[model samples]
Target: MKDELLIKFLLKETNAREDSEVTEWLAAGAANQRYFSQMELIWNVSKQLAVTSTVDEDAAWNKFKENAGQLDVQRPRVRMFPGKFLKAAAALLLALGAWSAYILLRPGYTTIESAATVRTEILPDGSEITLNKNASLSYQTRFSGNRRNIKLNKGEVFFKVAPDRKKPFVIASGNTTVTVVGTSFNVKYRNDQTEVIVETGIVKVRNGDNEVLLHAGERALAGKGINLAAQKNPDQLYQFYRSRVFIAHNTPLSRIVEVLNENYDARIRVADPEKAALEITTTLNDENLDHILEILALTLKLTVVKEGDEIILK
Candidate 1:
């Protein structure tokens, strides 16, 4: 593959055909993959280093040269292929320094991940995002050009986007793309499906060519073979992560159990299939798992049984 084409691919400026060409070239051999990886590392590292306004390029180059000399002196093994090693090192240095200017002008992504608990973050554009447990979100470190783009890799997140009429806030999750201007919404992406619930302003959820505009109290689900349409949000259970409370209004026991299993460490199940259809109307505050189970058992006249790691309700 041509160096120009690979550079274009790295910069995401390639067309579909060019992209396919690079992909085919990369899959040809391990040497191609390693070469690409090295180039990618240099591009990423140079961009990171260029972000610092106080970076002294000349001083850094001198320091690296000094370190290289010391490594050669300390490790005699590198002397076996001194010509190849030195040539590679010289090429890396040239590539890094040359790309520093170009990479510095481009926008890079910053990723935020929530491990076992919900995490709140404020973006560079002053937008607030609360990520549920095990959720991953990535956005540009600096909102540039025409839009603020965010990617939801997995799990659920609530976005309180700041108003920017010129630059719309866009979130790409699975096959769904949500576009909004100054809106608060909850997005849950899981099992190949993406659900969007709008709380404040209007949100546009698009899957493939179909799109739905959702207002406050409205939501839409997009997935394989699922129609993109707005519907009234049935319950406020989506707010459980942010509010630390589960408020179910005539919700099925099965749905409640699903949410509980998601939030708690204990596994909950309905032993009787018929009992799973039982409706429950209650507000479960920040109570412990056992207490919540006890409340459910008392309300439904069901028996709570503990069998190993599972909590069974019959």
Candidate 2:
């Protein structure tokens, strides 16, 4: 790319064809991406300086000419172009315009993701969410005028919504929709099922014609081709990801392995499907994987085998 065209691109003064070219260049390689980032930083810094400093371009030009004359005397062999000075001044103005246009024309939504560990975030409406690993949540940049909406793209998320009677907080997860006002709840969407566990206040969960209203200490499970059902959640074991305490009350061994695999990225399998069907009652707190595995093997009367990164129980 030519220096002149690059300057124009940085200033957002490019035509449609030039803009497409710039986009292609940015996508070409990491080096081009880095160059554009540096240029954007410079443009932003220039905007900040323009806001804080009173610049008199005419006075600055006169001062520059004065300094240029002394430099010319020191290096008499060098030649100067009059158009170069005007181009430099134009570039400075273009940088300022670029920053203004970027703020106005850019369209984006807030997206949060958790990769290897759980993440917690607060939204514009003061709602809080704790995202499990590999989970993502996205919403519009603006959440105002009687509604706050977000989409749970993948994995589980625990929401604590701020009370807003006039404006409702809605979350769309797969085929199900969870609505609430001033409530705290956990919504997990996996394997074609959406599970909602209410921690406080009230929540309305819906899937097609099926719907259920849940209160504190209650939970609802919904899936395709099935109705939503509300039940008493006696054990708060689901919150173990955040509370560091795992409490299991007749929880299936398969369920335990599922939770462990989700959080720890471990590969654990039962030798027999019947073994996983067995339920166990136990409480583990901040325990290592091996220790927890040992306890499960002992309590369930199973043999634990370790091969490479995989764990198998028989």
Q: Estimated TM-score per prediction?
A: 0.67, 0.63
- Candidate 1, 1-314: lDDT as tens digits: 55456555776867899889999999998767765775577555545444333444345445454543311122213323233333443344555553442243335678999999899999998999999999999997656557788999999999999999988999999888999989899999999999999999899999999998999999999999998899999898889889988798999999999988988856999999899999999987798888988989999999999999998999
For residue 58, model 2's alpha carbon misses the true position, in angstroms, by 54
Q: Please identify model 1 stretches exceeding 4 Å from their true place.
A: 1-106
Error of 1 at 139 (Å): 0.5
Q: How well does candidate 1 match the true structure, expressed as C-alpha RMSD?
A: 16.0
TM-score of model number 2: 0.63
Measured by TM-score, the strongest candidate is: 1
- TM-score of model number 1: 0.67
lDDT value for model 2: 0.74
